[model samples]
Target: MQVIDLLHTATRELAEAGVDGGDLDGQLLLGACLNKSRTELFLAADMEVPEEARRVFLRYLERRKRREPIAYILGEREFWSLPFIVNPSVLIPRPETEFLVEQVLAACRPRRGLHDGWILDLCCGSGAIAVVLALELQRDIVAVDISCDALAVAQQNCRRHKVDDRVALVKADLLTAFAAERRFSLLVSNPPYVSRRQLRQGLDPEVAGYEPLLALDGGEDGLDIIARIKEMLPVIMRPGGEVFIEIGAEQGPALLRMFAPSAGAAELVKTVEILKDYAGRDRVLHLLLSGYGR
Candidate 1:
């Protein structure tokens, strides 16, 4: 069939299967099958698809129809304007997480010699944040994740971005493997924050069915991992260090309370504030450790 006709069929199939952005997904998949850019496909809409390419496009279409994420199908996703490999083993990097990177860069850019100690990327899925930080800061980083499979994917990304030598991958649950020596000067994470209730209610089929659960389930209150990170802050973070954590939109207040100055909390915390995403909803929790105080 002609490129245009095949694209129409794929789009209709995807849309009927309840896929969002079906037309765009069709274009991307079809273009991939033909080994052509979307623009090239559009320009050559009248050209007939080769038999082999048509079969591959149909297979890709079926996968999309089953709610598999395009990134998983394509095996890559762009974050911080750099392409990173992704799979079911690791969560696909989202655009909003770029804001977390921006906040970290902004926080460290003004201070000379801020990269003195190690930068820890906790729960570093696919090493997207670590790769970006290593490139942007020219600093050494330790990217940690609990899943060995995720770490494997992260290692590929680090090598792909040519930051393998700079960004070390560690398999550990949070900071459990690290010594309590306050080694990290800066920390960033996009831990699982989707509440159990939220998951039970439902997420898009692409997310609920395909993405790694270890990277999505934030536990009963969605703060299980976040809280654990909070508890380890005193041991892992240097006095003047800062932590940037990506959070759910409605999680800002709860995080604030969790880190608030109370009997057991906020002793090591100097400042705890939530940064809003583009939509003005809480998306990142920026915490400053007390002592040398930046």
Candidate 2:
């Protein structure tokens, strides 16, 4: 069949299967199968698809029909304007997570950033944040995760981006695995925040069935990991250090309460701000840690 005919038929099939953005997905898959750019495909819409290309195109259609993510199918996702490798082992990088990177860059703009330049990237899936930060700043990033499979994917990404020299991948849950006497100048994370209740209700099949649940489950209330990270801050962060975290919208007020000037942590946490994304959802928590008055 001609490119245009194949595209039309594929689009219809995907849409009928309840796939969102069927038209765009169809074009992308078809372009991949034909080894042509989307623009190139359009330019030669009347040309016949090669027999081998047609077979690959059919396989691509079957995968999409089963609700696998396009990024996983393509084996890449764009973040910070750079393409990074992705797979079922790691959660797919989303645009909202980029907001966390922006906040971190803004916080470190004036200084040399990571003094002695030691930085910690917790729950560093795909090492997307680490790769972006490595390129954007001169720092030593120790990225940690509990899953070896996820770490493998992240390490590949670091190598692909030529940041392998600077990013250290660790297999640990948060910071407990690190015994080095190190203090980070800045700490950044995009930890899992989806609650058990949220998952029970069902996510899109692309997410619910295909993506790794280890990267999605944030425990019962969704605050379990966030709260744990807060407790570990004083031990890991340098005086006057900053933390930028991606958070669920509904958790803003709760985070405020958790960070409120309390008998134990009031003096340790200097300032807290709930920043919103373009969608007006409360998305990130910016914390200024200056220590408990020396």
Candidate 3:
């Protein structure tokens, strides 16, 4: 069968199995199997695929038919205009997290000593935010994650973006693993905030079965990690520091209340702002902090 006809047939089959962008997915799978670009695939539609190539592509199609994410199957995903290596060990970086990164970039601007100013990217899955900030802002950064496998992917991405020299990668849960002396002017994260109830809501197979549970399950109420970060804010941040976090859409007010305190080690000076994703859901939390109330 010709490649174009095969793609049409595959797309119909995939769509029946609930896959969107069926034709694109089919083309990508075939191209990967043949080590050809999509344009090449288009040009060679009439060329016969060898038996070996056909078999390899069939295997990938089988996985895609099961609703496995194409990114995981491809072992890479692009975030913030940069390609990142991804696997089940890490959560797929989402466009929503980009808003948090933007907030940090804006806040971190106009501040002196940026070269020496430290930025900590907590739960640095795929190191998307950390690498982008380091490369774009030329700031020193430390990216922390609990899973070593996830950190490995993050490291590769850092290298790909050529920010390895500016960013330090650490394996730790939140900020707990950092030395006490380590303090940052900016702290950012896209921690797991999906509640158990949300998970029970039956996620897509691409998300539920294949993606790592460690990167999705957010404990009973989904604020477990966020709370921990709040408690450690005092020790981990310098004076007049800022934090940018991505929360579940419904979590903005709750998080603001939890982190809000008047006479504490890390007083919430003001809620700088909350930003919504393209879907119009509140997804980012920005907090301005002053150390131990001056």
In terms of TM-score, how similar is model 3 to the real structure? Answer: 0.91
Give the best candidate by TM-score: 1
Give me the displacement of residue 115 in model 3, in angstroms: 5.3
Residue pairs with backbone overlap in model 3: 265-292
TM-score: the better of candidates 1 and 3: 1
Residue-by-residue lDDT tens digits, candidate 3, 1-294: 667776877798899999899999999888877888899999998988888878777788888999988888888887888888998888887777777787778767776643344788988988989989988787788899999998999888888888998889998878878666636878888898899998988888889989888888888889898888877877767767777889898987777667655434235454455677778888887777754556
How would you encode candidate 2's per-residue C-alpha lDDT over 56-149 as one tens digit per residue? 8888888999999989998989899999999999999998999889888877876654455478889998999999998898667889999999
TM per prediction: 0.97, 0.96, 0.91
Worst 10 residues of 3 by lDDT: 262-271
Arrange candidates by lDDT, highest first: which order? Answer: 1, 2, 3
Deviation (Å) of 219 in candidate 3: 1.8
Prediction-by-prediction clash tally: 0, 1, 1
Off by over 4 Å in 1: 292-294
After superposing candidate 2, which stretches have Cα over 4 Å from the reference?
112-117, 180-182
Q: For candidate 1, write residues 1-294 as lDDT tens digits.
A: 999999999888988998878999999998888889999999999998999999998999999999999999999898988989999999999978999999999999997646677899999999999999999999999999999999999999888889999998999999999998988888899999999999999998889999989899999989999989888888878887888999999999898888888736656788889999898989999988887434
